[model samples]
Target: MAVLTYREALNDALREEMERDDSIFIIGEEVGEYDGAYKVTKGLLDQFGEWRVRDAPIAELGFAGLGVGAAMAGLRPIVEFMTWNFALLAIDEVVNAAAKMFQMSGGQYNVPIVFRGPGGAALQLAAQHSQSPEPWYSYVPGLKVIAPATAKDAKGLLKSAVRDNDPVVFIESEIMYNLVRDEVPEEEYLTPIGKAEVKREGSDVTVVCHSKMVHQALAAARVLEKEDIDVEVLDLRTVRPLDVGAIVASVKKTNRAVVAEEGWPMCNVGAQVVDDIQREAFDSLDAPVARVNGLDVPMPYAKNLEKLATPNADHVAAAVRHVCYAD
Candidate 1:
């Protein structure tokens, strides 16, 4: 095992996948010459050359459509947006063209494309650039949404996303690029998509979260432990085909649940999770399923306000307390 930052792990994943498959290529703004906006593609251009690591203009829609076309032509393409906020410009290609091609053609075409980049709020990027769009893509049936909270999961899941025969929207946290690290395996391995893993085990309550929220949940679990509240942390690595079995099992064991997410509350991923729990594990729940989510309003631009608006360990711990009925 080798310790690697989230950014370096992603870089390794792309490098390894491209090395194994001749048809896989990467295309995005500044991906080649500038080495990507977040430097996740650093040194890839020199390794694969301009042909495979081609740079596109600052046009998300055009380049994204090109990727979809390339995928339909039997070449796998990794499309990176500087940030998901910028990907709003390319939703048409992502939702309509790439996602619908296979189903529309009755499985005649496979859109093996991965659209990835930093998502959700970071620092004080403000409302426009700080929005979380996971629910938007996950709402669509044809698209698979993946958000990995750890370096190891990011590397393995990305490799799986690239090889998937369907359109995938891979969201990364802007703040966690260099902030999070993990010991990644040296040998090749793939983290199965549509599975949830219990990061920490307990019996008092279950704290379910995904992406960056997983870290917050883990921290909250630590805080609760001091007060004699055993909190279990479950990370939903894949947001689309959610591991309902895992969720139900954890909720049954704990008899309580609190969902944490970086997105807004209205029709958010948490909302779906709550609904699923109520329907599938209604008898197991001891209290109402609670949610700790980003403020319903647009993300604030002020530093202090941003901190208050985003969900954190304090927020998650409070939600856990509410579900567990603890002070």
Candidate 2:
């Protein structure tokens, strides 16, 4: 096992996948000659050449549509959007063609393609670029939505997404790419989609979250432990086909649940999880479930305002305690 940053793990996955499969190639803005906006694809162009590691024009819709077409024609194409905020330009291709192709074709065709790039809030990137669009993509059928919170999960899930038979949206956090470091096995591995990982175990309350919010939940759990309030933190790695069973079981033991997410509370993935828990484990819950989510407003450019919009460790801890001890 070697310690690697989230960015390095992603690079390793792409490098290995391209080497193992001839049909697999990367196409995106600044991916080839520029080595990626985050340098995750650095040195790939020099090794794989222009044909495999291509730098497409800044037309997200055009290249996304091209990637969908290529995947339909039996080529495995990975389309990077620079940032998922820009992916709005290619919504027609991603939501319509890529997501609906296999089902529309009556299963005769499987678009083995991966649409990836940095996603979520970073610094003071304001409203447009700071939006978390994973829920939007997860709403569509035929598209697999994945967001990895750890270096190991990032590497394993990317490989799994690339090799899958359907379209996959592999979202990475811009902030976490260089910040978090963890041990990643050198040998190839794949974390199956739709599985939930228990990052920490406790018997008081369950905190379910994804991506960077998972880290926030874990940190909150640590603080809660100091206050004698045990908390279980679950990382829902994949958004679609969410692992409801894992969440139910955790809530069953703890008798309390707090859903944490980076996005707004309304129509968010956290709401879905909380609904599922109530439906499945209503009797087991000792208190009403709580949702710790971003403020229901556009992210602001100011650092303090941005911090207030996003759920932090303290916010998660408070939510857990409120849910656990509420009368």
Best by lDDT: 1
Give per-residue CA lDDT, model 1, range 1-327, as digits (tens): 999999999999999999999899999999998998899999999999998998999899999999999999999999999999999999999999998999999999989999999999988899999988899998998999999999999999999999999999999988899999999999999999999999999999998899999999999989989999999999999999889899999999999999999999999988998988999999988999999999988988999999989999999999989987885
Q: What CA root-mean-square deviation does each model show from the true structure?
A: 0.7, 1.1
Which tens-of-lDDT digit does each residue in 103-194 have in candidate 2? Answer: 89888877999999988999998999998888888889889899999999999999999899899999899999999899999786899998
Q: In order, what lDDT does every prediction score?
A: 0.94, 0.92
Which 10 consecutive positions of candidate 1 have the poorest summed lDDT?
318-327
User: In candidate 1, residue 314 scores what lDDT?
Assistant: 98
RMSD of 1: 0.7
